[model samples]
Target chain A: MKFNILIFTHATATHYPMNYLASIGSYAIMVREVFKKPTKWRIMKSLILKEIDDLIFGSLGIIIFISFFIGGVVAIQTALNISNPLIPRNLIGFATRQSVILEFAPTFTSIIMAGKVGSYITSSIGTMRVTEQIDALEVMGVNSLNYLVFPKIVAMFFYPFAVAIAMYIGILGGWIAGVFGGFSSSADFVEGLQLDFIPYHVTYSFIKSVVFAFVIATVPSYHGYYMKGGALEVGKAATVSFVWTSVVIIILNYVLTQLMLG
Target chain B: MIEVKDLHKAFDGSPVLKGISTVFEKGKTNLIIGQSGSGKTVFMKCLLGLIIPDSGTICYEGQIYSQLTPEQQRDLRQEMGMVFQGSALFDSMTVEGNVMFPLEMFARQSRSEMQDRVEFVLRRVNLADAHKKYPAEISGGMQKRVAIARAIVMNPKYLFCDEPNSGLDPRTAILIDNLIQEITREYNITTVINTHDMNSVMEIGEKIVFLKDGIKEWEGTNRDIFRTDNEAVSNFVYSSELFKKVRQMYLEERD
Candidate 1:
């Protein structure tokens, strides 16, 4: 029994890496299919517009809500951590600026969207696959991947705009928290926000946003498009997509930060 | 006409289609019927080029599927329309939008012209009034009609339906079957249907291929089916006691 258990464990351990490799290979092929032989521009235009509405415009409320509270929390935390009087009150603003712009607005918001937009893309496409709608597209001579995923990639061009709004709201929330929480005066916080504001940091954030947007769109699409089984599997695919999307975003966040800012 | 020569397909080393060959004639409703696991769906998919056969050739009007280039295959697909088992209507689109989809993708017509074509096909499917309703809002029968409308909107030269009447009642199933037959005749399309509905086989099956365990067990017309002595075909065809009695009555009345 012990030997049998050992063999089973060994087999399971070896199988997972192979599965991961296979998934990666399939994902690469799916990406190639998405770029090949696109549908007519007129139809694609409408699809993109719809995706923008579904993925970006629809996500505004949650992004705004999360960004505001997290910004306020970051400000309060930074203010409380400073024990020395020599540390300027305006330093609260600087901390919030660095935290929100460099990481929170771009990376954290994407993690949230990896759940929201990622699940939506996966479940919708997965449902289509389950119901043979993708097969229907193929029978009609439509490039199903190109028709489905390319619009998503195009729509994610607007993702940076969502991130931008998050950035602005985040900073504003920091101001409100720092001034009203009595940690710092309004003037000092605003002054700190404007001081040493590196234009390059904002540029870096936007660049990260673009890459993260592509990951969010394509990863979930890959999950959804190739998913087999039925409605239950669609839900499972969505959860798996969200996990992989978040993981990819965090890893990319680290690598991109190193390449751009290191 | 579509000629499939010794088509073979397997999944995960288990053969689903084991060397089957048949011909589907133009302007006729050809039915592929079998028990649930008899690989009818797999056979239809192989014909549609959705699944590549492990061996053998499927020729669409003499152009072999396996030999065609990707671009050629795509062009061939443009001439084909398929109705999926579950209707496969785009839930996001209304009836008009669903029917207009193929035209929007393939046809280059003015807005008015596209609308006209959409209207014509919807009315042809007897869905003239359900244009604005979404697929979810309609009955199963109506959804099947919408699927038919979508499939025929492009005026395809070849039409394939995968269980068009699977979820429909007997009356609606006959209506859909008749509608498919009418369209096939009207358009001169080489229509292939994958179904297990015995009613469809008896009603509109101009030609029928019976599959058992991935092999073509029999091939004949509906008229031939009534007279065939093949036990497997008879057992399947007359499985229900009602059908058995009806077959007895049919033979007695003929005698």
Candidate 2:
């Protein structure tokens, strides 16, 4: 029994690297397939419209609500942390703007969308896989990936719009909280927002949003399109997709920030 | 006609389809009957080109499948339609949309033309009333009818149904069987069905292939099945007491 346990452990330890590599390889192939032999324009047009409604339009409510509140909290925290009189009260607006724009609006909102949009993509595709609808498409000579995943990718091209809105709302919320809470004056806050306002920071944020948007669209889809088994498996795939998509987004966030902002 | 020559498949080094050969004639309802784990699904999937056989050739109307280019193979698939066992209709689409999917993808007609074709096929399958209803809102029998409508909407030359009557009542199952047979005859399609339902076999099986342990155990018509002395075939076809009595009656009547 001891020898058997040791062998089983050793086998499992060796299997993970191969499994991870295989997953990455398969994801690359799936992405390629998604771009090949496009579906009919008329059909794909309608599909893209529907996906935009689901992935972007449908997500606006939550993104706006969270952005407003998180921005307020960041301003309050920065104001409270100022112990020395040397620090200007304008620093509240500056801190909130940088935090919301640089990380919260783009990366944090994406993590939430991973739970929201990513799970939706995974569950829908995984359910199709379970019910053999994917096989049905293949039998009908339809490119299932193009029919399913391509539209999502196209819809997410506009994801940066959502992030841009989040950035605006978050800064507004910070102004409201800082002024109303007596943490900082409105004039001081506005001046701080205008201080050292680099135009390239917006570019950096948008760039990260684009890469994260692609990760959001494709990673969950990869989890979904390749899932096996039945209804239980669909639920499991959704969970797995959320975890992996968030992980990829975070890692990409770090790498991209280091490359572009360092 | 679809001709299989020495088809073989294996999973995890364990062979499921050892060596099998048969011909499914066009304009006839060909039934593949077997107990579970007999490679019936695998065999049908192979015919549908969903599964690639490890060895052997599947020739569809004198065109060898394996020899065709990728484009050619996809074009061949356009000529084929499949009805999965669970009535694998698209959940999001209404009945009309589900039936109209293949047409939308490949048909070059106007929207009105596609709609008209969908209506005609739905009417043909006796599902004209359920146009806007989703698959989940319909009965299993209605779902099966919708599946049949979708399968034939393109006027495919070959139709493959994997257990078209798996979860329906006997009466509904009979209706589905008859519908498939009527369409097969009407279109002169090479219809291949994988089923374990004895009623389906007796009702519409123009040619029957019995498989056991990954091998073809018998091949004959329905009448030939009743008269066949092969013990495995007999044991399977006459497994129920009711079928035993039916077989006995058949023999006595013949005598």
Candidate 3:
């Protein structure tokens, strides 16, 4: 297993530069595309509206539903286990905050977003490509990249950020139910949470989400736009997009964590 | 008013378009017709610079596409309107939105001006009510109409249609043909159509270039093509049972 892992790492190291270069160029092109269209005001209007819709449907709904179930389980488990006398009573709050900002907000929010935003970017762009609407844009003298991919990038930035915020709130709900409402003293938990909570952590979380938004926007759009075959390829594109984006996000999180900590 | 000179294209290792030279005329429905795999579509895409030729010159009126920089080539490309084989309308957008898309991106038109143009084109295509409907909500014929509407909304100097009648019913096919022909005459647009459809050939082919096996086999108009004695074209045009019977009648009249 170790040997296999080493081989895989070497393989990734070889491929990383090409992907990195392509990605940076993709972002530059996306920025140029935004300038090719109407002013920022109209683009932002559409993007925000779309993002709000995506967040509400995607992460917000999932977080509320998932939080209640997970929260209930965590609460019962915490109540059953916390019989140690010397262990700090407020440790649960620290665990909750760290978990929310680091893992739950970025990772869980993405899982929900896979079905909502990622799949959407895939199918919509895939359909457009299959139908030849992309070609139509090119023939009409409109920059196909700008019109198709630009608003999506902007929309992505807003939607995933919204989803991350919702995921953070959902984690808090879980914490409240598990730490205070069910097991620990409310005062102890709240005080512990306030004491450890740093503004930098929040910034880190937001920064990760923004980067994730770029990944979600660009990867799915690229897959969809270059989609080949017929009806079946659309579904395949979406599936590939979900898998790749998820993997990239995890790797990115690890890198971000290393930078932020060290 | 488009000139293609000694154009060639290859994929992987196999050549798809040989040295093809043809002038697609202005103010007429000039056609590039061939069987499937005859490289007509490849030729049209080469004309549009979507597929660059291996070594050749495509001069749009007077400008040589091969010699121009990429930016200048892109600028020249913007003067074109294309109706795709599948009626490539944006699925997320309503018909009106799709029509107005080019205007919003390329022109400095105000919102109301764009709206008016979208409505005008949609009305021209007999899709006024359908404008509010998403591409998915519309029928295939309606989708094609909307595609045509979007293509012509810009009043392009060059109009390119690739297999415009595919997946369309016979009656709808004629309507699309007439619409395209009328638009071509009305705007005096240098209209280029790629098709092997005999019906279309008879209807609006003022100039036609025929291809066989990546090479130009014949070039003539619909009326002139019938009277020509080219053996390959005769075999192609008279291969059908219906055309065979029609040929017999023509021979009897000549006798």
TM-score of each model's chain B: 0.98, 0.99, 0.95
Scored by lDDT, the top model is 2
Candidate 1 deviates by what RMSD? 4.9
lDDT of 3 at A159: 54
Report the lDDT of model 3 for residue A103. 62
State TM-scores per candidate: 0.95, 0.96, 0.87
* Candidate 3: residue B75 Cα off by (Å): 3.1
Off by over 4 Å in 2: A1-18
TM-score of 1: 0.95
Better of 1 and 2 by lDDT: 2
Q: If both were scored by TM-score, which would come out higher, candidate 2 or candidate 3?
A: 2
Q: If both were scored by lDDT, which would come out higher, candidate 2 or candidate 3?
A: 2
- Give iRMSD, candidate 2: 8.4
lDDT of 3 by residue, A1-262 (tens): 0111222332343358565555445445545554563434565477557655664444566656664555444444545576888776665655565666666666667665665677888888788777777666666555666666666666666654565555556556756676556566776656656765778877777788788877777767766766666779889889977987888788888898889865
Give every prediction's interface RMSD.
9.1, 8.4, 9.1
The list of candidate 3 runs beyond 4 A from truth reads A1-48, A55-58, A67-83, A159-164, A179-181, B110-116, B251-255
Question: What TM value does chain A in model 3 reach?
Answer: 0.76
lDDT of each: 0.90, 0.91, 0.74
List fnat per candidate, in order: 0.74, 0.72, 0.52
